[model samples]
Target chain A: MTPITADATSLFDKLWQARLIKDLGDDRGLIHIDRHLLHDLSSPQAFAGLRQAGRPVRTPALQVAVPDHIVDTMPGRGDATVRGGADMIVALRRNAVENGLRLFDIGDPRQGIVHVVAAEQGIVLPGMTVVCGDSHTCTLGALGCWAFGIGTSEVEHVLATQTLVIRKPSSMRIRVEGRRGAGVTAKDLALGIIRAIGINAAKGGVLEYAGPAVTALSMEERFTLCNMGIEASARSAIIAPDETTFAYVRDHCGSPEWLPVATEAWTMLRSGPQASFDREFHFNCTDLAPQISWGTNPGQTIGIGDAIPPLPEPSAPRERASAERALAYMGLAPGQRLEGLPIAKVFIGSCTNSRISDLAAAARIVRGRHVAPGVRALVVPGSSRVKAEAEHLGLDRIFIDAGFEWRESGCSMCVGMNADRVAAGERCVSTSNRNFEGRQGPGARTHLASPATAAASAIAGHIADCRQVAGR
Target chain B: MKAFRKVTGTGVPLGRSDIDTDAIIPQQWLITTSREGLGKGLFSNWRYRDDAFTPDHGFVLNEPRFARAKILVAGPNYGCGSSREHAVWAHLDFGIEAIIAESFGPIFRDNALRNGLPAITLDGAAVSQVLAQLAALPANRMTVDLERAEVTGPDGTAYRFTMDEERRRALLDGIDDISATLAHAPDIDAFHSADRIRNPYYWVQPPRD
Candidate 1:
C-alpha cells in the first residue's frame, strides 16, 4: 500500500493503510492482526503446531478462544457432554491455558460463537483488523473492520506470529438504496443480492456496503448482512461506523476512559468524499421480498411470492445441468412456489442470525401461535448474553410456549456437528448461511431464510412469509 | 508443506458448480484433531453407497478408469462454503495433487497454495475443452507445470494463468511462512509499540488467570 496521496481513499483502502505493517512486495502486505478469535474445530491444530515449533503466541492479550462449533446445545451441558466434541473442547482449554490466552469455558457467561462474542464483549473494535479460522469471521466486519476468515494453516501462522501475508483485494461498493419492504430483512437483502448478481460478481475484492437502506439497518442486521460476504465470493464487507455503531460499541466497550479515544479514531474510518471503487453495484431494495433458497446454493433463491425458476435453457449447458441437479436433490419441481411447501423442521440460529434482535423478530411472528403438529422447531441464541437478554425480555417464554424448543447457545443445527441435526431426507427451513446439499445433514434438504420466516414456517408447517403471518 | 514443480497424470472431470467443502468432507468427520487418512471421507456422500461402504460405481472417483487420477478438472467455485482446510487435505490425500477449475473460493485457493497444492484457474471455454476431452477418454494424460505457469490439457491445449508472486514463490521453494514472519519480527514489534496508543481500547489489561 502506498502512502495516502491527495486522492480520496475508499473505506477498505483506509483500513488497509491503518493495519498495514509492511508491504512485502507483489501486492501482498504483512498486516498486523489486532484481534484473533479462535474456536474449537480449527484452533487445536494451530495450537499443536505452535507447541511443535516451540513458538509462543506473539500477543496473547489480543487473542481469545471460545468453543462453539462442536459443543452441545443441550441445557446444562459441560465439556464432556458432547459425543465427538469433548476432546476438541478439552484441547482448546489446554492450549489456551498453555499460551496465556483467554478461554470462555463451558460455564462462563460469555461462552458463545466466536463472532457473536467478539461483538458483545468488544473484543473486536471498529477500524481494526480482525481474523479467525472460521469462514463466517467476516461477520465482524459489521463494525467497519477489515475482518475475514483464514484456513488452519493461516491460523497457525497468526498464532506463531501476529501477522498474515494477505493480498490487498480491490475495493467494490455494493450500494443498497430505497426502502426495503416490511418483512424483508438483512438476510433477505443478502440473498436477493446473491440472486440478482452471480456469486462471483465481487470475487477477489473487498465489498463495502453503502446507501440509505444499508445505513437504516440496525447493527444486528448489519452483522447478518456482512456475514454472507463469503457467499458472494467477497473477501469481506464493511459499513461505515455511524451513530448505531458507536452506541453499540459504547455499551460493551470496556474501559469507558478509553472509549472516547477509540470513538474519535473510529470517526475517521469512512470513505473520502470522492472515493472510488474498482467496481460498483447499486440495488434498490424497495421491491425485495423475503428471500428463500429454492435450490442447494444461496444464489439459487426466489422471493417468497415468486415461484421457483425453470431450468436454464440449453444455451447455458452448465447452468442447466446445475439446476437439474439442485432440483433433483431438493425434491422440487420447476415453477413450484416456495411457499406452501411442507417442511419437517425449523432452525433459527447461526452466527448469521442468532442475536437477541433475531430472536425477538422470530418471537413476534410466533407470539400467540403453536407450532404445527408434525414440525420440530428449535431456537438457539447466538451467545450467552443474547440468551439471557431474550429470557429477560420473555422471548424465550414466547418461543417455548408456542411449541419451539429453547436451547443453549452454540452453532446449533447450522453446522449440525452436535446432536441437533435434521434427520436424513427431511426438509428444514433454517436461518443459517449455507444451504449446500447435506449441509444440515446427509440427505437433508435445507431452505435458507431469515429468523422471521423460519418461525412462521414452523407455525404453519410449511414455507410462510412473516408479513402474512403478522397480518401486515 | 511439499514443494511443487510439475505433475503429469490423468484428469477427472466433475461437472458441477458450487461444490462446497461440506460436500468434499462432511461435518461428521470434522471433529478429529488431525487431517490424516481423510481420503476415505473425500466425497463420501457421492462415492459411497449405504453405511456398509459399498462403492458406488456411478461416481467418477469410484470408477476404475480414473483410479490413478492426480488432477481434478471441475466447474466454478470448486471449494465454496466453510473455511475447512480438510477439503484441500482430503483432495491431496486422495491422490490428487492439483485442482484446475473455472474459479475457486478465495480461501480455498489460499489454503491450497499454502499446502503446496496449486489451484489453477482457466476460463470457462478452456475448462470445457478439457472436461470434454476427459469425458471422451478418461485415461488421457494432462500436465500442470507451475514453473511455466501453464497447464497442458489432454487435447494438447496449453492454458496460461497468473498467481500472486509472493505466494507462488513460497509454494515453489517450500518456504516456512512462520519463520519468514519471525525473521521480520523487529518490524512487526516496532509497529506494534508505535501504534499501540492509537488503538487504546483494542488491548486487554485484565491479567490472565
Candidate 2:
C-alpha cells in the first residue's frame, strides 16, 4: 500500500477548490456553475420563479435546455403526444428563447437526454462544476466533473446568478479491485456496491470511484456506474479522467482550436498518486455475478444466481417493519429465486443504460431470438445521435426483428411520465436506474437490472440470467 | 414560501426506511406543469386503493389517529430517490410543515428547506424514541423549534439537532435562494472571467444565423 502525504487531496477537493466563488461563512460557499442542464419536468417551475422575480438568466450562454423527461418516445411522436405535457414543452422553449439560451427541441440532431447530450456535445468538461434540475445530473461526473442535482429553487438560483450557495460534502472513495467476471456489466457492479453498503452508506458525501476495475470500464460503462450514485444517497459521484476518458471526449466533442490545450489540462485532473479520502471502501469484483433488485430500493439487490434472503431481525423495530412492508409490496416470499419469476414487460433505456454500447450488448442477446409470447419489450436510445448510430450499425433491425419495439430517443419508460408506462398489476424488468415503488406506474412492479438481463428476460418471459441465456 | 420558526403538530410515524419520492408522489401525478392540487396525490399508492380513491385502511397516514398530523417522523434515509420538488410540494400541500428523520437524501433535504419546510435530522436513538412516544400516545403533539434547533415530544423529552446556520436562517426568514446567490455577483464575475479564459472552448458560441 502506498502512503499518502499529509497534504494529499482527493480529486473532489481540487474541483471544489477551483469552483469556489465566495466563502459565505459557515460551511456554505458560492460556487460557480460552468454548465446548467435543464429538462422539461423540473425546469418549468424554475423558469416561473425567475419570471415571478423579474429576473433574467445571468449567463445564458452557459445553459442548455432539452425536452426529454416527459416527451413521448413513440416513433411518430411530437410534443403533443406528451399529453398534459404540451404546456411544459412549450414553456421550456419559450423560456429558452426569452433567455437567449440554447434549446434542443424534439427533432434536433443534438437533442437527447440532458446528461447524455451534455457529455456527447462536450457541454460538460473535466474539473468543472455542472448542475441540472434532475437528480441524475451526477451521470456527467464520469467525465471528471463535479456534477450533482439541485432543487427547483437552486435551479432558479443558478439561472439568475450562474452560481449556487452549497455546503461542501465530505469525500469518500470506493475502490473496486481485481477484474470483473465475464458477462458482468457496470450496472451489476453498481448494484453490488449498493447492496454491500446500505442505501445511505455515502449520505451527504462525494464518492470517487477508483481502482483497477473502474479504470478498466469504458466511458459508457462509467456513465452507467455513476448514474446511480444518487441511489446511495451520495451528493455526487466522479471518476478521474484517464486515457479512455480523453479518447471518448476527443471522438465526440469534435476538433476545436483548444483541443490540444484542453487535452493537456485534462491529464492533470486526476488524483495524486497517494490521494486520501475521508472514508475509503474496497471491493473486489473478481467473482461477482450479474445483480438484480428484488425489492423497492436499489439496495434490495442480489447477484443473479442468489436467492432472495429473508428479512433480518433488525435491531431497530422500524427496520424490521419496513423490511416486512417491502417484502409485502414486492409480493415475494423469503428465499425465493429471482430466476423464473414471470415478467410482463422489459424496457431497455434511460440515462443509466441507454447508451449505444448498452444497445449493442442487448442486441447481441436478442439477435437470433424473439421476445416471448405475451411479453412486451421496448428499446429506447438515450439520444438521437445514439439512435442514429445504433441504426447505422443495424442494432435497430436486430431488435425490431426480435419483436422489440424500437422507439425514439427520450427518457421513455424510465420515468413513466410520458405515454410509455407499465400498466397497473404488471411486472417489468427494466434497465433504468430506480426501482422505487410506483416509479414506473401505480402498482407497477419494477425489477432493475442490466440491459443484457432485461433483454434475456424478454426472451425467456421471466427473470433469466444473461450469462446462461446468451451462452457467454 | 412560509416562514418556519417553530411548528407544533402531531407526528405521523411513517416508520418506514427508504420511503422514496416515487412512493410519496407517483409519476402519474407529475404530468401537470403546475404544483397545485398535488396534496391529493401524496402517498396515493399507499394511502388509497382502487380507482375510486378510497383510503387504504392499513396505511399510516390514513389511520384515523394520524389523519390530520402535520409533522412526519420517518425512518432512516427518508425521501431517498429522485430530485422531484413535487415530493416536497405534496408534503406541504398535505399540510406537513416538517419532517424528522434519522437521515435524509441530500436533494430531498434541500428541496424541503427551499420550500420553507424544515427537514430535521436527529440520531437514530432520538428518532426511535420519538416514534415510540408517538405510537404510545397518538394524540400527543410534537414541536420543532428552528430557533433552538430542538424537537420536543409531548412527554417533554427534547432532542437537539444541527443544521447549517445559513439554511437554518433561510428557512426562518423565508429568504429566496436566487436572491441570496445573486448577492455574490462580484465574486461570480471574477470566477467566470478567469474560467472563461482558462477554458475558452466551453464558452465559445456557434455562429448565429
Candidate 3:
C-alpha cells in the first residue's frame, strides 16, 4: 500500500472541488451542474414554476427530458393510453419543446427510464455533476459521475441557473470483497449491502463502492449495484472510473475523438491509494446467496434458505414495533421461511434490473419452463433500446413461451405509476428496488429479489432459490 | 416560498421510521400538474380507507385533535425514498409547518427547506422524547423556533438543532434562490471559464435525434 500523503483525496472530494462555482463555506458551495435530467412526473411542476417566474433554461443543451414514469408500457404503447398519465406526458413534451431541451418522446426508440437512458446515451460522464428530479438518478454514479437525486424545487433551480447550493456530504466506502456465489447476481449484492446497513445509516452522506468484487462487476451489473443507492437514502452512490467504465464509455460517448482524452483525464478522478473516509463497511460476497426481502423494507432481507428471525426484543421499541407491524402486513410469522411462500404476481423489471444483461439472465432460467398456475408474470424493459436488443436476442420469445407478458419500456409495476399495479391483498415477487407497503399498489405485498430469483419464484409459484430451480 | 422563522402549534406524532415519500403521497396522486390539494393524498394508503376512499378514522391525521396540529414528529429517516417534492408540498398544503425527527432523508430535508418548511432534526433520544410527549398528550403544543435554533416542547423543554446557514437565511427571507445565486455572478462566471478549459470532455453535447 502507498503511504498516506498530505494530498491523498477521495473521489468525491475531487469532484466536489472541481465543480464548485462559488464556495459558501461550512461545507456548502454553489456547484456547477454538468447535466440535468427531467421526467414527466416531476418536471411539470418545475417547468410551471419557471414559467410563472419568467425564467429561461440557463443551459438547455445540458438538459434532457423524457416521459418514462407515466407512459404506458404496452407493446405498441402511446402517450394517451396511460390512465392518468396522458396530461403529464403532454406537459413534458410541451415543456421540452419550449425550453429547447433534448427529449426522447413516447415513440422515440431512445426513450427510457431517465437514469438508464442517461447512462446508455453517455449523457452522464465520469467526474461530471449530474442531478435529476427522480431519486434513482444515483444509478448514473456507476460510471464514476458525482450524481444524486434532487427534488422538483432544485430541478427548477438548475433549469433557471444551471447551479445548486449544496453541502459537501460525508463519505462512506463500502468494500465488497470476493466473487459472489452462483445465481447470486448484482441485485442480491445490492440487497445484501442494504441489509447490512439500515435504511438510514448513510442518509445525508455519499457511498463509494470499492474492493475486488465491485471492480470485477460488468458495467451493467455495476449499474444494478449502484441503482439501490436511493434505498439507502444516500446523497449519492459512486464508483471510481476504471477500464471497465472506460470500455463502456468508448462505445457510447458522443464524441469518439474525445475518448482517449476523456479516459486519460477521468483516470485521475479515482480515489488516491491512501484516501480516507468518514465511515467504512466491509462485506464478503464469496458465500453470499440470493437475497429476498420478506418484509416491507429492503433492509429487512434474508438469504434464500434463511427463515425470518424472531421479532426484536423491546429494548428498541421503534424497531420492534416496525418489525411486528411489517410481519402482520406481510402475512408471515417469525420463523416463516421465504422459500415456497406462494405468490400471486411476478414482476421482472425495473431501472435496477431491466437492462439487456438482466433480461438475458432471466431468459436463461425460463427457457423451456412455464410459469406456474395461478401466477401472473410480467417483464417491463427499462428502455426502448433494451427492449429492441432483448427482442433481437430472442429473449422475448423465451419469456413469452414461459408465460411472461413481454411489455414495452418504462417504470411500470416497480412504482405502479402506470396501470401495472399488483392487486390488493396479493403477494408479488418483484425485481424492483423497494418493497415498501403499497409501493406496487395499495395493500399489495412485495418481495424484492433478483431477476433470476423472481423468474425462478414465478415458475415454482413461490419464492425459491434460483440456483436450485435453474436446473429444472 | 414562504418565510419561515418560527412556528408554534400542536404536535402530531406518527411513530414510524423510514416514512418514504411514496407513503407520504403515492404516485396515484402525483398526476396533477398543479401542486394544490395534494394534502388529500398525504399518507394516502394509510390515511384513507381502501374501499370507500374515505378518511380512516384510526389514522392520526383523521383524528379530530390532531387535525389542527401544524407540527409533525416522527422517528428516524422521515421522508426516505423517492425525490418527489410532492411530499413536501403535501405537508405544506396539509398545514404542517415543520417536522421534527431523529434524521431525515437528504433530499427531503432540502425539499422541505426550499419550500419554507424547516425539517428539524434532533438526536434519537430527543426525538423519542418528543414523540412520547406528543403521544401522551395529543393536545400538546410545540414550538419550532428557527431564530433560536431549537425546538420548545409542550413541557417547556428546549432541544437545540442545527440548520444550514444559507438555507436558513433563504427560508427566513423567502427569496428566490436563483436571485440569491445571481448575486455571486462574478465568482460563478470565473469558475465557468475555468471549467471550460479544465473539463472540455464534458462540454460535448449529444447530437439531435
Q: For residues B70-178, write the lDDT of model 2, one tens digit per residue.
A: 8999988888888999999999999998999999988999999989999999998888888888888745698999999999986889889999888898888988777
* Candidate 2 Cα errors over 4 Å, as ranges: A1-7, A314-316, B206-209
TM-score for every candidate vs. truth?
0.97, 0.97, 0.98
Candidate 1, RMSD to the unseen true structure: 2.4
lDDT of 2 at B179: 68
Query: Per-residue alpha-carbon lDDT of model 2 for A1-472, expressed as tens digits?
Result: 9965454667987888878988777777888888999989898888888888899889998899999998888887778865688888888999999999898899888788999988987778788899998889989999999999988878888899998888888888899998888789999999999888778888868999999999999999999999998888887999999989988877876766777898898777877767877788888998889999988888889898899887787665665676676677788877999999999999999999999999999999999899999999999999998999999999999999999999998999999888898987788999998888788887788899999999999999999999987532
Which predicted model would earn the best DockQ?
A: 3
Total backbone clashes of candidate 2, pairs 3 or more residues apart or in separate chains:
0
How well docked is model 3, in DockQ terms? 0.72
lDDT per residue as tens, model 3, B9-114: 8899998988888899987888888888998788989988875678889988888889888999988899998889999999988899999998888899899999
Clashing pairs for model 1 are none
Give me the iRMSD of candidate 3, please.
1.5
lDDT by residue for model 1 (A425-448), tens: 899999999888888888889999
Provide the clashing-pair count of each candidate structure: 0, 0, 0
